[model samples]
Target: MKWLLQLVLTLSVTFCFTTAQNPEAAGRASSWIGGAEHEGALRALKWLEEAQDLGDGGGGWGSDAPRALLALQLSNCSWIPNAGMKAELAATKLELQIALLLWRHHEPPISPGRLAQYTLALGAMCKDPRDFHGHDLISLLLRHEPESDFEFAFVTLAVCNSGSHARKRHIRRLLDVTGDTDKHSADTLAMVVLALRCVAQEHRHRDLLRFVAPPALALAALQQADGSFGNLHTTALAMQALEGAGAIAWDRGAAMNLVLSSQAPDGSFGDTFTTTEVVLALQSRGLAQVSQCKCNKPRLPPSDTELGNFTFS
Candidate 1:
């Protein structure tokens, strides 16, 4: 039976590799940060830089999560030596810093900024950032803007090492922030649950727990039996929520085991951006595990020219 289960997982992974379509930005970013080929990681970063929000210097408009995600990915690539890689990383860092500054100091309802975006992006850069930043970036995030699901969840992860007071403040702020927003689409709702669950785990809040229960249960009920989620990023975030909300007991060993067994051989994930986000989330959890999956596809040599070489920028 054990061998049979391994066979099934192997076959399922093989089929996914044979059929993957457009490279998912999230998955690729995760793999790169986890130490995949430098060129492949660069390509993913390039995609993210190109996709930046030109409208705002920070990267994009309201809650530009993708651009934020990509910038952080570029930041993680800082260890590389290639000129193109270095340049791209530098650009993303500046863009993300600018965005973070905007979120902290900019007016209006403090939407997720370069810092928040960079938070997840940075998660992709390496294992995690628990030891990376010194100043309370989460406090910076709260002071500047209204809390949302994304912000709450991110701040909780960011403040893992922070003292108790700040954790409560962030969690309270998250609950307060999402209470008023009308953005209850399935995805947004999932984001809200994600935030609440994480915060709740660190510092239990009855109100937040009450608020998150229905959605959290709904999301867990939605998980497929094969462990393949309906949506990749959503599933990943939902996992965070479940773990946070105490739905799944915080067993790092068990969780890591489940994740290892579920990962695709190509080092990518099961759903969209599967590779990128799975790595990011796992790293954020402080798992030092590296990806065992390798691409069977031919490796591309790094191009010496900049991305804009073919077209006028």
Candidate 2:
């Protein structure tokens, strides 16, 4: 009877652990749209789609392909008018741009941030970052000595998302950096939490949770009376990071209220970049889940008038 009880207890623990780790089980649907917050997210999605530059030799928004792609993927806006074709075309152009950049610089094809961004963007687009134009972007990102804490955190996220092993040294460095509360800003701490969370989820390393705790705490501490971490972009990032780390103590409701309050009449949070981050945060999407987003609904074709006048610029 004692042995049977222990077996049942162990199974219960296992089920709880699995459920906590699984995003779907945790009620984090990739493309959930209905509530006020979700409606705001949809508005931001439309703003981003319309903001895409469809002019000659242009297929990106805000001159940043990876960020734009990440935002689009998070929203799963393929069913929104002509967003599907726009995303595909933008992704292709971004891929070609990456290839050209690699061709030009053999010594070090791209900066760590740029390479990380590209890896993330490709992953979101369902493209393999490892074999992009015969260049191994993940390996290249690992080789660089990241110039800043932000760069290091970005690289770690990219590596983890690409299904590649994050180096222990990099993880250790990030842990060390995150411990110094005086030096890092809210954005940096938020990024560190996100990167560590990605590594923890991918490797199932429960040990990393302790290391992730300090940064997550610091990020929560940065929350102001209005629930913003100084600004819209950082607040949005913090919301996603804290949630991703499972830092359940933070006041998510207040933070979300602050975010929702900032949406413009056009559904954007100021610029393309800010709107992108806000949309992701509003949806509870972490970088790791960006590539996992899938739209199961049958795509509706855009009207001829919509396609013919798609150019925003």
Candidate 3:
């Protein structure tokens, strides 16, 4: 009897350890996305074990590195008991990623669009934007100016993070894009709405919504038979934007299901960068929800006084 009891105890411990290591896999069938995938994010994160130079003077090709860390952070690997990352290994990996990004500095070809994306990831993890390895990432973004629809959208997110508002020119540009039914894709239109929703005042907010409503509705109509608005990327952005805009109610079940289907068995969405983008999109948040930023808060400094002071002429 004594030997049997000891054997049982050992087996129990082994089972528990295995479960902890890959807990997300067990829950995969039930939801499109959830906290369980934080493990996958962590697992995928291992891909960036070594950060070398990004050949385009871009410092590192693994731009998704910061995002992988944020996925783990937002999922509450710590503070949420029974969560994974309790092992020393998980914490070490996180620290390593932070060090990797911060130490590397912002290299060239890091456009405002790219920098804003980085800022969101860093801010999501509670890291400082102003002090990123001696780079004021926010200030750097200002220098690039907005040309692409994506840049306007990201800058809007950056503004929300810092408690700022949209400028007249940017608002105009975004509005112009939103008006063209045939030009921008669902993702670009979603991005436009995302920016407008974050910064517009009461009346303007309503008008912005009114302007976006037609496009937003049209985008929703584009939902494929599989429930995706377009491809994995467009679908992800559209889901977040439509949900955030209050233009239409979302069937999260359907949306999540679509996203989950695209993920490969290895916890990647086809490749490294897509995996990161999907991970972020799965988190289902707009950058403007600043209060959700538990870490260093990615927005600009808290003074309305500082909102537009750094813009290019």
Candidate 4:
């Protein structure tokens, strides 16, 4: 209990937030353009917090526990568990989640992609995947063979966040099997760009980063005229990559519109999973950009996109 909630306030208050210089950067972006849209974002966040498994963090896998954890990290959602949920969430809730994941990992085995994503959720909140309970996230991923473009992207991001060198070989294997061409989906391209950027930062492999430019271009080309990658789930992830890299100028309006439009009157997305992702994507718009998801790492070098400039180690 004390172990978990102690860091809640510190973590909640420290996340980055920044306003877009131009509110008009995109048409509907104007909603989030004003920082969480005040009422709307909070409504969405409130819905997410309520969706938590109050007594234990094992509500569901998709966005129930880990995904919601990530969403809370990305947005300024109120992490103060409700009077009842707070005490519960701050105590055995985390432990319950760890135990469940470990149990699953041993039996059927958590999918490589889900493991990578779970690692990300933990790392985003400043938790260590190296020693979560008795499991090592990197060790888990090392044994996995990624089956999709998204899996590669998630694994790359997980490694970057943990700063683990042992998994580099595995990541390279995934990359070698993947393509950075137009054939990839926007979601896939975005993940590739993000994973490559993480590689450049963690390993200083600028050579790998150079290959990211094509996928970035491919992602830009995939955008619908409306400013979303066709749906809130994909668009939210794609926007994170584009905004984080500061590459491939995007239709801010479209991106913003997608987030704002996806929100229901209840202040939530269609469900717990999409709501979690949607909130993070919209929330990021108003937050100061970070150099990388690695908690502490050198910035990325200037991208060819010429939108946002950063430096990498």
lDDT of every predicted structure (CA atoms)? 0.42, 0.70, 0.54, 0.59
List ranges where model 2 is wrong by over 4 Å.
1-30, 53-62, 77-84, 106-109, 294-313
Q: Which candidate's TM-score is highest?
A: 2
Q: What are the TM-scores, per candidate, against the unseen true structure?
A: 0.40, 0.78, 0.63, 0.70
Clashes of 2: 0
Question: How does candidate 2 score on lDDT?
Answer: 0.70
Candidate 2 weakest lDDT stretch, 10 residues: 19-28
What is the per-residue lDDT of model 3 for residues 1-313, given as tens digits with 9 covering 90 to 100? 3533454455455434543553221112112245644454444433322221234322243545545444444444231123332222333333334334444455545457656766665565555665654546666665567777777677766755554445556666767776675677777777776676766532134445566675666667667777787777787677767766664755656766777777666566766556555655655343444336455343433345434443321
Every candidate's CA RMSD:
19.0, 18.1, 12.3, 10.3
- Local accuracy of candidate 4 as per-residue lDDT tens digits, 1-313: 4533544443333321111111211112212435545556667767765565334433543336676666665552223222233423432344445555565535777678877767766665555777765467766786676778677666766766665542445445435534536567777777777777776655556656666666776787788888888678888878767775656677867787668877888778888878776666666431112223335532334334322332322
Q: Quick one: RMSD of model 1?
A: 19.0
Model 2: how large is the Cα RMSD against the reference? 18.1
Model 1 lowest lDDT segment of ten:
286-295
Number of colliding residue pairs in each model:
9, 0, 6, 10
Least well predicted 10-residue stretch by lDDT in candidate 4? 18-27
